[model samples]
Target: MTTTPPPPQVVGPAGAGARTGSGDVAATLRATKKRLTSPWATFAAVVLAVLWTIPTFGLLVTSFRPAADINATGWWTVLTSPNFTLENYQTVMAVDSSQSLLPFIINSVVITIPSVVLPIFLATLAAYSFAWMQFRGRDALFVAVFALQVVPIQVTLIPLLSLYADIGVAGTFWAVWISHTMFGLPLAVFLLHNFMREIPGELIEAARVDGAGHVTVFFRLMLPLLKPALAAFGIYQFLWVWNDLLVALTFAGSSNQVAPMTVALFNLTGTRGSQWFLLSAGAFVSIIVPALVFLSLQRYFVRGLLAGSVKG
Candidate 1:
């Protein structure tokens, strides 16, 4: 009867292990919830998305309302106003030769498509040579090539315009295209060269051993693998050319039909202010093509276009 309550029933090893495991699981759950429910991260993301979308949302709402309503009231009053119409878009699209945004859009496409495709082609060739082929002063030349990106386009604009003037090509589509190509090349070469250099040398060696020429290897193997970077650069080039007013205005003639969307939209405004309603509608309209292009090609960026190009 002198036993102290069966020695207080000591915890067995299994029971101790179970209790420790439970404590660890509980701690992990708390840490997971703390991470997931972090207020700062969630708030920052929500705030950024909302801030980014506000202007787009405002323009969309404003575009549907009549000019009277837009000038009279804020876009917030949209729900209060019972009427919505496509008249703004209708009016924007119905411009005459002095202000036809659609033609300008086509012109932008002409400039942008060629600008993008040319650079990619040229860059790919240079990248392939730099990455795989051996030649004199290759590394030194690449460094000089990369050094070109540091120079601002503003610095070159006057010189290029002067050159174009001398060449009797100052105000033409060719001038704009060539200027875009030259401006875009250095970065293009740098990026594609980096991507191509990542390709394993063994594959190039094997392809060479199989009697495949450089052009054949490039088209068959490297071209397919470069899709992601090509898409990325293509989209970037298209956007730059589409949005560029300076080069288009400088190199492309006002008389020439190839004055791009930016120039067209710029002239849409009067000295006092734009036809705000028209400007908003035209602005959105101008963005539509680039948005579609970006969406179409964006998937290529995440895709591993280089998969299986080399052995592990």
Candidate 2:
């Protein structure tokens, strides 16, 4: 009353006009920043991509080039000399009716598949029991389990060898598979248990109330959800088993009958001087299976990473 209605402050074109002006300014700034940063990001990405891929590209080129070309000519010459040959691969595989890649790669699969699967199968069961079921000394037991990783591989090598010898599995594929599975169990269980614990507790209880047994719930609900963790572990274990030389050399023979590609590749170089040329091919061959493994399991690997990111 005293102010006689102070101009009845209300929504007006002035207020709307000011807000619209501010919005335009903000949008322009954002667009400008994006435009300015894009080139720098692209440049950095190009540099990184080149650095990351050059060595692998060189290896691929060397594998195709003649040994002399490989030794004398730079891999960069694939751009110029442009000469290509399969002779190096032929030479590496020619002697004694050996494909060089075939038998050793097959042997690696035999050793690695079982080793990776056995540990994962056993670890999943153990992890489920550890995470969901209440039992005696559970926490202490888990700590002890995790602590096993601290034990050096060398520390148990002799004991494991002796055990393998007693079991008559020494120098056999079983020996290496068993050895790898045993060594890999602790970490596998640890990783899986941690992943399982992050699952909502109510889901498990709901399964329980539905009259589903623990085994049923695990196989039905938990296993499907653990896909990511399983994939992550599988890729890691497969690579480990595929590339392992020490365990393979110790437990399996060097005859290439049982030895994996890693051991086979090692023997490719000798007093004839380093067969660095074959190394280029052999390294790529060895990586193929691991790449396939990752590609096949990558979906779950991503899920497993995100599973624990948010709490209920």
Candidate 3:
């Protein structure tokens, strides 16, 4: 008679577990929101934002102030005795002048574009292979690639320069391009591989069942999901190449035809050490493209950075 009750029937709905999970998630979100909206949190956030913005705002104000005003007082004094001029920017950008930064800007574009593109293209392929393919020594090869990231660029610069010289590309844009691509590869491969591995294995298995080859899966399925990662790495590499002074100085020397804006800006400091107005203007000019690029692609960059941080 006691056994006849046969395990008192569980009366809940089939989705009870799912409902519990959703409830926990909602509670977590609510707690997080509460913490973020607390008065202390709001005050801290405001303080941090103001601290971060002050230096950049000061730099911007200095860029517009006249040379005499810059030399005479701090940028904060502009609140009382505001004076502005475009002469610094004009002189820095003037065409056919010894101090013109326009050509170096063009050279930066040339060096940066290929440096960004080549590493991304190659890293994507390498990451795909490492993530999905089965091959002897694959894990070891990946470890080796990851290890290369720790090797300081300074250590290899001399040897790499010698190699470039032997290959007849030293003192040219090719040398800088190759060096950047080389330095960028290990980090790119590591990040892209981490992102790719986070993708569902079921998708790849389903594609394989549909008779799709590696190339088909990579192009049709993976590429679309990889846009965030690609944009992230592209932005990083672009900024690095664009703002680079050491590589440009090492490989391209002071030749304006091959030197980028950083080298030019550096030389500007050396030659016109007293010209704070011109230096400020050139600094702003150098940062403009990077700021624009970052602002535009920031969403993708955030998503890419969050890759591999969670699991379902």
Top lDDT prediction, candidate number: 3
Candidate 3: lDDT of 96? 77
Give one digit per residue, the lDDT tens place, for model 1 in 77-181.
Answer: 767666688988887777564444667767887888888889889989998999999999999999998788777777888889999999888887889999999
How many angstroms is residue 99 displaced in model 3 relative to the true structure, after the best TM-score fit?
A: 1.8
Model 3: per-residue Cα lDDT over 1-312, one tens digit each: 565666524423433354655565666667667877998988999999999999999988998988888888999998988888898788778987876778888888899999999999999999999999999999999999888877877788788889999999998989989988888898889889988999999999999999999999999999899987888877777777787777888888888879888988788778745677777888899899999988988876565444312210
Error of 1 at 74 (Å): 1.7
> Could you give me the TM-score of model 1 versus the true structure?
0.83
Candidate 2 backbone overlaps, count: 1
Each candidate's TM vs. the true structure? 0.83, 0.80, 0.79
Whole-model lDDT values for every prediction: 0.78, 0.80, 0.83
